[model samples]
Target chain A: MKRYNEKDTVEMRQVYADTLLELATLDPKVVVLEADLSSAITTTKIKNQLKDRYVNVGIMEAEMIGAAAGLAVAGFKPFIHTFANFATRRVYDQVFLSLAYAKLDAVILGSDAGVTAEHNGGTHMPFEDLSLMRIIPEVTVYEASDATMLAALLKQGYKQPGLTYIRTIRKQAITLYDTSELFETGSKTLRKGTDAAILASGIMVAEALAAAEELAAQDIDVSVVDMYQIKPIDEDAVMEAAETGAIVTAENHNVIGGLGSAVAEVLAEKKPTKMYRIGIREKFGQVGTADWLKQDYGLTKIDIVKAVKHLCSE
Target chain B: MAVHQVKDLSLFAQEIRYYTLKQFVTMGFGHYGGSLSVVETLAVLYGKHLNSTPENKTDPERDYFVLSKGHAGPALYATLFLRGFIAKEWLQTLNQNNTRLPSHPDRNLTPGVDMTTGSLGQGISAATGIALGNRLARRDNWTYVIVGDGELNEGQVWEAVQMASHNKLDHLMVFVDDNKMQLDGPTKDISEPHDYVEKFKSFGCYSKRVDGKSTEAIDQAIEWGKKNKGKPTVIVLDTIKGQGVHVIEAMSNNHHLRPDEETTKKIMRECEALGERIGVST
Candidate 1:
């Protein structure tokens, strides 16, 4: 249950592997299916420990998803893993049909979310996975902001039915919460304030929290909420944030149809909140380090803080 | 009760045709083309093969049937009704509001429906999954999935095909209703994956092509599929669109056409004649 240290920077994938290994021991129905990226996602430990429960289905992502569905049908809780790009973009039809369309109790672990696959560049970086998955009728999309929730999401994922997409960033990330943090399938409101609210997800949650701290220094109080769960997004938390005057949405994902779009949709329907979105503008990421890509996409804490001020001023 | 003779198999196909026609008449409109083409295959499975109970519909040990080309739900529903898995009166409520029998077969909603499917190229994957699951569970149940020749155009179908072959899902049998025609004329005109036999064989599957309308041929293919040890079977059914209904048989647009009153009367007459021709009483 202890996902990350209080101030440690650990990849979400480590938590995923730990949770997967734990599930293999506790739940007989738990199975892991990967598409030739077991080594990349750091699930080798899980594969070694739970060999019978894990299946390396070659580089066939679509087949891997189908096999996962098969495992689910056989009364096994199957967690499928691949890069975010391969998991979502390559096998969209499989995810849509074999998993979500059939309403199978399957979890798809999409690692290296957004521009996190930095050196791999545009081909591997999935900018619109959340957007594509959230529109499905029965899919629950979760992107872990840090290691703390990755383990929690994996545990919660097996208990929940239907198709679940867990977007995990593989690189070391700034840990936001202690291991005792109560994380669920829906969004978790991390910080609370009244002057203005900053909604964020994935790695941007750390930036949002840092931005909140900086804003407090400037005498501008800002609330930060971690909208980790994209679909079945914490509507109450979003509505409450809108009630706090201004809202600024930030994410490492694309500006369109990602966390920002999901929150904007909720706000557009309810009380219209004056909000600005801080994410990748309709563009592909270039080859660089994960940190460089995050900065190049204007997903740093400074960007979040600037967006918070702009939305509050407007 | 033992190995069904050719006459009995032919009669069973007629029964399938009769029930399918009746269901379509009840639904007003349905995918008549694909359903009619797969009637013999369904008849052979239900009549000569599949160890299922109409009474104990949820018997976990029973063989499973998944219609990959799920637009043909009317056909499967009709077959299930005739098998006594569902009440005949329920067939009349097809596609109605709050009807369990929607345009597609929903297992959660309907009795004897193994999987919920309507999206093309998906049911096969579920069926493949079911077969794999059964194997994992050490269950003796075999899964049969029917895919349309046109539906094979979907890349996901190939994905399932590859997985099925790779897993050596010998208990799984996939039947392709190679009726040649799709919603847009012919399958070749749309997307051509020529030589499904060779394609499946190359993919490490035991592949065979049989006259889908011939009940005896379909039964033999099913038997062969069942006997195959290390590979799954892909039985390509060479069938005709609008097979049993004469009026629809003549019209190319029968894929979505609902029989008018006059045509319905003619359909009844033709169905009766066809029933007699196949040596079966409706």
Candidate 2:
């Protein structure tokens, strides 16, 4: 077992920029598009290096998507970036029709995932981005759990065909995977037990690990699995966890159509295990720190600990 | 540029009108007005300008055409059929169940559709992106798109326009089908579109308005646009909704007509008249 580290390493945005620069430098067909948020995602640092391959479409998310479709038509693989809310909710029809419906190849990186919007508040926070993306046919949706995972997913997203949407946070996250770790399997189990399984993603993976450690102190043995790819979810790992007879899903998004819902759908059809979903429920976000918001939304380690205990006991 | 070439293009325009009406009549009811409005432009494009044929239509390096006002797909499909990009039999399948030819253009389903567009104001943006991509790749392939005047109401059209002009995508050309009618009513009654030429010029395009029903004027405007460098071009096409058919043109609401017995008869008569002009049978 790889012990969890609480220390934050490199910012996810930096990893995104570095990986994009590496990919763009290697492939002429790779194009990067930003909707006036180049500085926000640190893509502006590579502007001179990428030259014509980098395009900033100036506050037009819909136009960016349309252009990406066009670029895809002309044999260019486009990587488009914008805030999660703007990328999904603001220009959903464009993403749906121009990119996905047109069968064009493009990867959309939606930074500042739910709760991470922090001071940007409810208007910028997207609890439904996963829901919006998951509904689109053949669109591979992923939530990056850490810096190395973000880099790995970005590289994979570049080579894959069809439409892909990756939800990520722009700031530093708790270090999980090392640089050598690969995310090709879509998930990784950090801890193992038979009492129950704590299935989590993104920021919640760290919390789930912490909860598992705390539960271990009390002699309640539970497992923690990082389910990164939300759409083509790791159903095999899910069923494996379902063997424990108890499961608790945790995420930073709304419970309605995100990780919790995805896992519940698989379990409902396959195994029918006892489960509890811990995430934002029937609420909007506001101006607050990410830590405070996670506590308010019941998305902390304690919340996962409570849900795991309740589900296991029941 | 020759007199006989313009005459041949004029006959091609009539052929496009003929096939467009054939598809609409086959579908029972379709976007006849908007479809008819862009016949001459489609003829001019397929017959003379576009560097694409049935064999090379799938080639990525070939010139691209995106019908932004995708309700006018029948016009494009008719042009593609005449150009041999699609079989004549596929013309009967427009909007039918499990048909490749939907009500709008679909790139994957239809043989010659460069972009799928039904939701208005999106095709133009895709066209601009294609143009930019071609420019970056140093390909001489040109990207052309058509947008309805009513479709201009979507802010995304302007966003694409701004990006196209900013990028100086000289190989890109836009055609605004100023048919002056929308689904609800006249465009003027719905939204006051002040002046397309001036608006496009302000957005950094070399724009010109021409008689949309005339193949010669459209061909000449495209020539002028091709000569202009350092910017994309917008050709504002001044045309009637049900262009080339007097009875349909005179109708107050011909945008999407569910014709009565008499109206269907009249439309079929006009179709026969067009086929006669083009030396083809309806």
Candidate 3:
């Protein structure tokens, strides 16, 4: 059993900045492009350290994606950063035609995923970013769960080709893995049980683990799997969890076209199972604290626990 | 420039215009206005200025060209054919099923196209990035781009203009195909594009306006842009919507025309006359 840590480690934004700086230091081809969000993502270090290779496009997300495509054409690996909504919804056409349709190689880190936008409210929140990225042909999409996973995916996305989109929260995340852990597989099984399985991603992974712990005391053991990569999702992991007969999916996004929908699609085609999805159901975000918004949107561990209990009874 | 060189370039421009009309005739309908508007600029660049060739186009240090106004792909394809980058037979396959030459420029499909562009306002930003990348590598490669006057309505173009000027992309030369028209109507009626020279000058470029039909004036502006360093250059091409052909140029709605039988015959006659003047048979 992989034990979950209650302690909060480094912030995901700092890890992203440090990893990018390290990558740019070693390889001259690595370049960083920010749409005037260096302070937001803690990448001012990169701006200061690698001044020659860093580009601040100044609040223009469309130009940022286009510039990244050109840099990729010139044989330079570009890592673009912006808010999740700006990265996808604001410049969907640019990302689709210039980067994905043109078959260019670049990595995009879309921070402030979903309710993590907090007081920035509905306009900044991106509930459909994963959905938007998945529809683009051959685009790799991942939602980073913790600091370790965020760092690992950033390193991996650097070597991987084509368009890679990593959705993450910029704040501190709960410690999930050690420095020695490698994330070659898109998913990981942290807990095992027989009654049902809880598949989750992003901020919901921690809630799913807590929900499983609560369900154990109620004499219903549930498996918990962390499904980080939404596109090219780990089907083997999904199938293995299906052996439990009943499944529950939790996410920080809308129930449509996200983690829940991805798992359900695999199950409906390969092996049909009784499943329940716990997420925001067609609602926009509002100005509130992260904890208040998560609770208001039914994204806490209690909702996951209730969902699993309902599935087990049915 | 030598008189013989000017005559050769003029002949090359005529040949490009001939091939452009032939592609539209093959397709039966296409962007006749914008495609014909940029033929002379394409001739001057491919014939005299650009260091890119069929042999060295893949080289990182070679000069690059991006068709920001990508509806004019036929003109670029015709220019590439004349430069030996593509075969003459491919000109007939424009917009055909699974053809390499799509209605818009695609870098992966076309051998000589350096950037894939169709959606307006993106190619200029990409061109800026290419110029910045070459400068980062310490390569003296120049990056050239052609943007439509109407395409400037996209805010991304101004964003790229600000970026190129801020970065001091001295090797980047942008040519505005100021044809005074877009798909709907005249650009002035659609959106008041006041003065391109003043607009580009305010955006921190070494801006100039010239007769787009005069290849010699365009050649001189490019030479002057190369000499003026520490910022990007913008050459505003004063051209007609359907240049080089009187019948098409006279049409009010020549942006994308599906010619009638009589009009098609007139266009073919113009192509024949241009081909004869360039010492080629149509």
Candidate 4:
């Protein structure tokens, strides 16, 4: 097995633009909307390529969401793009009422997810987008772990036929899946073991795999899964992981209601296994690189390793 | 193909207002003032300008209506009920338990309701979305949205205003229910930025001012708006808090009212007297 450093990565933003252009090519109804950040993946590229598919709704995020819903009503598969901060918290009501409650076909792309906001600091970081989007009934909330997952989710989002929120990181994503593989909305297990199961989403999937590999070197067995879809969480996979009787959930979000809460919701009723969450412990993010932010917030592979070990011991 | 005559539209306006009051009375209290203010506008749009019928509820090319001032749902429900999109039986069920009609318009629950809008300032943006979608599809569809003057205070409304104009949603017509009143009191007291006509124009909209109480004026303004090309039109409908009913219009606060027996009877008396004088033979 080979360990990945910074070099083995692709920009999720460029992958997003290409995936969106592919979707637009496949279905002319696929349209993208951005709030002044036309340079972001789905906005400028789609505008340049499709001619009439990209809409720059200026800096108005709520209008971007509502207009996306309106586009949904008019038979266009609309994808709205903005930072996760404005995408979830600022325009939440529009997403809730105009998109979800109305049953519209729209994809909300909240980029620069979680601690990846980096130099943009706490105001730009969105650790609670998953929580807010999941509360809306039947909305498909997903976090793309790498370029491959980002590309897959972008295609699925175009034809989801309901409100979907896709959280993406703009910068580095350590490569996880081959470009040839196809994906749908569910969890995927990359590694298996008998001792403990590690559930992770978004950036934490890579971290979980790293933690599992480290544990394997010490003769400790642990499984890693990419819980990509958070709303309709893969319950069967969670149950399978629970058979190990110890679980560790990791994500780049608040431990209170992010992927931790989602996994807890499943295990609390179905399996009731010993669980630990490796994520930001109720703390807002600050300016730092993804690596520094991971260490600062205790979301590194080391943290996942510690949590899984603790769960196994208990 | 004779046009739906002016007297017929005027009569429909009276019917909309009457049913609006009846529903409010049944619900014991509701947002009646704004509902009353937009009846004539609704009558004109639904009766004359719209290409929708009960037989063609899902007609893709038909004009769409969005109630941005969604507390005025009773008026719209009345118009839709009278227009046969809803059964007359659901007329009295306006905010009752398990009723088909909710306080705000929901496209999922109600037929002929183009967009679900309760949260204010969002429906206008939905209309912009619909207009933009139609533009992208190169389809001949129109969206008529009614927004409150008070709703314009919300910054989100301005965002849609900017975007709709920037995209040149020429088929989107917005009616600013300039009812001068909000929940607290006069809009001037709550948020004092008037002259919506100038505001929409400055936002690059084809803007005009119309007397909202008059069906003919609103109808004519809509006609003029369709002819003015390359921009969305905003009809800043100059209206009192309550129109057509002297008693309601005279109330110190009618935005949402809990009319005591005396006030309710007085409203009924005034409404009937005015209806009779105007030959609205109810």
Candidate 5:
């Protein structure tokens, strides 16, 4: 097991800014587009560093996506960032036709997923963003586990073609891995054990890991995998995990059409793994801090521990 | 400076009508009412003005034509076929199951299509983006977009208007096909805003009202739009729905009513005679 360090204690938003800034420097064609919330989203830092490449289209989400499509047509790679709720819902038409349907290469960074925007209330919390974006045929969806994963994912997003939605969070998350480890797009098994397999993504990966550690003390060895890329899921890894008979799914999004559903889609077809979902139930979140929201939604280390126990009992 | 002789404009209008009828009949029937309304403007834009090629479809530096009122794709599709951007055979498969020419003009599926637009008011916003992009890149290629007068009901259309005016995107030219009809009923019955010309002028656009059927006026509008460099231009084309076919024009719901067999024959007869008059084949 790898020991986590304080060096990985960077905020995902700050990592997102740093990664985009580095990407802009590395590829002259890379451009950043913000929807008036650049400073709030912390992408203004990247804009400040890469002045010529960053574009701040004030408060016009639809127009920003449209302009990004045009920029993509003109041989420039554009990265658009805004709140997760607005990115998928408000400007869906523009993102659908202008980017996805047109097959234009653009990246939309959606921050604050699943009650991450605590005091901002339900309107700000993007509980169903994953479902909205995953419906688009060509979209590649990613939810980062930590700062390092976000940095790596943003780098990968810059190099990738077609539409990809990065479901970014606004808080500093615990580091799950070091930079030396390789991260695949679809599925990557982080822990290998015999009792059952734990499939988790985004902020839930850390909880899943902690739960795995607790379950191991009880003589139940559990496997942990980071299912980062939701669409075009790693079918092979899922099948391998299901071969062990016990399986559990988790994410920072709603249970429906998110990571759990994505895994279930493959498992139902290939191997029937006894699965349990650990996520926000079919309910909207209320105003609260990030820690309180996570606890209220059963998205904690204790929740994961209980879920693993239930799967074992079944 | 190029003047389109009325005879040539009449011929182009007949050709556009012919293709539109063919596409409508092939697809069983689509937004024929809206499609029929924009025939004159589509004729002028694709026939006499826009610089494009059927072969070099992906050329980055070429001028762009976006159909913001994309429900009227049949008119645009007919124009594309006439311009040789797509093979004439492709028209037969329009709106068919798994056809390249779906109800909307998908840029990925169709050649010479600048953007895929079906949702009203989005096409102009995309064209605004293209103009802004061209300006930023310092490219000479201008962008042109056509909107149904009824499509102005969408608020995004005005958002595009403000952006175009504020950015001073002179390379952009917009033609509002003021045929005065939409999905439900007439634009006046549904939600008639203000005088679009004055609305655009107040929004900072260089505005004009033109007899859309006259190719000479359309060409002049194009030249004026090109010569003016600080503000965007909107040419309000006062056209009639089903203008070439008199019977269809007389119908209350010209938007999507299929002409009877006799009416179809009459349209065919009119196109055939017009073709002969212009010395062109259908």
Candidate 6:
């Protein structure tokens, strides 16, 4: 029942940059490290304004993570930024040993998750970053559905202890929450219905909402929930959604270890329901627009609608 | 803090090595090559330079130490024990299940173990970050990290190196235990990261190559590193893979050993003889 839009308003990367700058100004302990992708990640403002507080560690994701851990060890909160794929996979060991195992307070901003890598192609697309981060013990894994959610999640990441990974998207996200509404560290209901529910995250959230709108016309009242916090997943909201008895999980990632898998696991365990998944199959990404990539990977609104229909029929 | 005599430093280094070897026997298996190579370095650190103590464990401005080549956890455990940073009861607990001293240095699990390191190259990067943080916090402290030469093969090490130079992390000092051996084989045969001193220089760090066995040389490097500010320092310690007891040093590969009952008895005997040679207070 919030105001919905269909055009690009503002990029999430800019929101990330502004939020970091604001945090730096608020807390002296907040130091940030960039892996030489500041311009691409759009953190130049923080770099320029907070010169002494910022470090550009070149194109080294693992080293950036290591230094972040060190900063945390030395009693300063550190935030590291890089692309999503490199952030989660390439430096996984460092993130594990240096940050998590060390039990340090640090935040990693892994920009460009899933097909949001757009034209950057397969090597850059991080369809499994969520799964990789979720596997780390005590790491608070998060993905933002829109700019508002990202700003609030980042603020929480700054004060939060232990290693935290914020899976960020560089492109503009369809606005999901209102200006007054803030993001919690769990899943939240976006549109309430009773026939079936769509548990979605990241870019798939808008698709899920669109599908909810389409299903409304068919008298199939579908609930759309934004399951943003992936690791410490909102089981309460999940059980609430499962009350409908039919569920469809959607995301811009592979079904193996992403939103689909996470929801499937919880639903199978807590409350068994007839469920369907709408996401990228076991395939790599390619050069295409975000919308095209969604359609190509069978992650569009149509896919969500189909899955919800199937769940309702079953 | 009393300045320990060089003789005391040498004696402490020998005792620490002896303790590590016995711990190996107790634990059944351990990293020997990397541990022995960094004995003198760890000794010079805990025994002389590091302003650390049993009571001052939580001191914020205390000099920080990071063992980047973390397989050498036993050596550090022995040194921490001798330095009063940890209890002697935990010395023989190396690699034991649920023991505070695991195979790798864990910061939270153990007292005075500054950084949790086992994955190579991360510790140095952490030290660099600590150094930068020290400057930002206006905390007067030096951050020392011991990294194996083979561990330098990790690309992240080079990345940290460049960032350290760029950030002017002058309070950070790195000791490269150039034992020339790694998990697979000789570092040259495995993957040669040729000329570390030159590599450090290229990365804009002040570097030196010194005999790792000589405590005086390590002391001098520390003195120089402290005086030279505006850039980080790297002391490349030229060392043998196994250098403590003659028997272990002579073996073709002493990096790790499974001490069967036969080998365990031989090592215990060697520890006794080495103890006597160093004048263990009997």
Could you tell me which 10 consecutive residues in candidate 6 chain B have the lowest summed lDDT? B1-10
DockQ of each: 0.45, 0.87, 0.80, 0.84, 0.56, 0.86
lDDT of 2 by residue, A119-161 (tens): 9998999999999999999999999999989999998898899
Query: Which scores greater on lDDT, model 2 or model 5?
Result: 2
Give candidate 2 regions above 4 Å deviation.
B1-7
lDDT for A17 in candidate 6 is 88
**Model 6 segments beyond 4 Å from truth?**
A1-3, A6-9, B1-7, B277-282
- When summed lDDT is taken over every stretch of 10 residues in candidate 4 chain B, the lowest stretch is B1-10
Candidate 2 C-alpha error for residue B22, in Å: 0.7
What overall lDDT goes with each candidate model? 0.81, 0.92, 0.91, 0.86, 0.81, 0.86
| Clash number for each model | 0, 0, 0, 0, 1, 0
Pairs in clash, predicted candidate 5: B33-B255
Q: Model 1: how far is A91 from its true place, Å?
A: 3.2
Which runs in model 3 stand beyond 4 Å of their true positions? B1-7
CAPRI-style grade of the A/B interface in model 1: acceptable
Give per-model CA RMSD. Answer: 3.3, 1.8, 1.9, 2.1, 2.4, 1.8
TM-score of each: 0.91, 0.98, 0.98, 0.96, 0.94, 0.96
Candidate 4 per-residue lDDT, tens place, A1-314, comes to: 64544423568888777787888888889887888876855357567787878888878899999898888878789878889989999888989999999998888889988889989999998989999998889889899988888888888887667888899898768888877867763988888899999999988988898898899998899889889988788899999999999999998998877788999999999879899988877688689887899999998999988888887778
DockQ versus reference, model 5: 0.56
What's the interface RMS deviation of candidate 2? 0.5
Q: lDDT per residue, candidate 3, A166-243, as tens digits?
A: 999999877777788789889988889999999999988888888888899999999999899998999999999999
> CA lDDT of A101 in candidate 4?
94
Candidate 2, what DockQ?
0.87
CAPRI-wise, candidate 5 is: medium
Native contacts matched by each model: 0.43, 0.82, 0.67, 0.78, 0.43, 0.86
